[model samples]
Target: MWDRIEPLMPADPVRGRRWADHRRTLGAIAWKYRTNSPWRDLPEELGSFQTAHKRLIRWAVDGTWEKIFAAVLAAADALDDIDWTVSVDSTVVRAHQHAAGALKRGPKAEASRLTTHSDAPAVG
Candidate 1:
């Protein structure tokens, strides 16, 4: 997988401070998402959490992530390892009647609002 993705990453600038190792940054990213944890919680051994987060955002904005995903999918397809079929059951998509724009108050409540206080019995 690394072999397939490494070529897609942006090359480090030749005349400035080198960027974090792509492989290490990627491991941090995978670990962060796999554990559903905050970026700050990333382990020190994996490299800086900020690096992983920044790389993720940068790649997303520049379309590098999309290129990597396409490369992976293409590889999987070539190996006959991907199933493109999609199935969704209609029963699983149900919504409540109120969600269909029903009245906020029912007919009984509406009628109650129309009643006049003068119609009530007098108290001694």
Candidate 2:
């Protein structure tokens, strides 16, 4: 997989790290996402959380992840490796006021400050 990815990645060096390659950086990113752990908790074998986090933020900004995924998917499809038979979808559930733990009695906090879709991939 890394062999396929090597040519697609930029050749720029990550600040403060001379030996880290694109494959290691991407693998570290995937490992972090798969485990859903805090960046600080990433295992040492994956390199510094700073490195992986910077890569994620950079890719998120530059759309590198989308490109990489598309390339991977294209490669898989060319090899007839994907399951084209299945479909999947999701629906958002809207709950009533009572469902929210916020109480009407307390000082109203700044509402809906959280954005679940920050840098989230679009699915059509």
Candidate 3:
């Protein structure tokens, strides 16, 4: 996987501070996201979490991650390795409370003031 991903990383054009090893940094990033762990909790053998986090953010913002994913998918498809089937399990996936229209606490009073007339009973 790293072999497929390493070539997609953009090379630094100018010489300054040396970049961390691509494999180690990539491993750190993968572990952080895979485990949903905080960046600070990344293992030392994988290199600095800050570096991995920064690189991930930078690549995402600049579309490097997207490019790499697309390239990998294309390769897989070319080799007839992709499965086109799709599945959804509602029992294992749930919407957040906010997405389910749970009321936000602080804005209700302000919202009612804006909607209700002072001299009249409020209508639903």
Candidate 4:
């Protein structure tokens, strides 16, 4: 699956041998996202935390992940892997006080204004 991604990656420098499997690199990324931990806190067995982080940042800049996801969805649609009959639900998440950080000594940041078009609900 990652064969397509290999060519996209830059040629590795000073290649002796890759110490980590691609899955291990992916696991490190998942762990980082799931726990919202700093990359520096990643487990050593998962490989260099900075390497996994740098990969994500590079992909983000290139929009590679977005393209990969879209391609996967297209393939699934072609193979009838998508269950179009599935139910749908709208879920709203409310932010709690914990989401707000402790106060710091600084001027209040200006909030961006929300605008709505004629087809959208009116904003008061």
User: Among these predicted structures, which one has the highest lDDT?
Assistant: 1
lDDT of 4 at 16: 82
Lowest summed lDDT across 10 adjacent residues in model 1 is found at 115-124
RMSD of 2: 13.3
Report the lDDT of model 1 for residue 69.
94
Please identify which of the two predictions, 1 or 2, would achieve the higher TM-score against the true structure. 1
Q: Looking at candidate 3, what is the lDDT of residue 5?
A: 80
Give me the candidate number with maximum TM-score. Answer: 1
Task: Report the C-alpha lDDT of model 4 over 36-124, residue by residue, as the tens digit.
Answer: 98999999888898889877787678887777677667778888899767677889877775576533343442221234446887554
Model 4 residue runs over 4 Å out of place are 1-22, 83-124
Candidate 3 global CA lDDT score: 0.84
Which has the better lDDT: candidate 2, or candidate 4?
Answer: 2
On TM-score, who's better, 1 or 3?
A: 1
lDDT of each: 0.88, 0.78, 0.84, 0.70
lDDT of 2 by residue, 5-100 (tens): 777776676675564667778888888889998889988988888988988898888878788889999999999999868667778888888797
- lDDT-superior candidate, 1 or 3: 1
lDDT of 3 by residue, 94-120 (tens): 799979866567867568555764788
Clashing pairs in 4: none
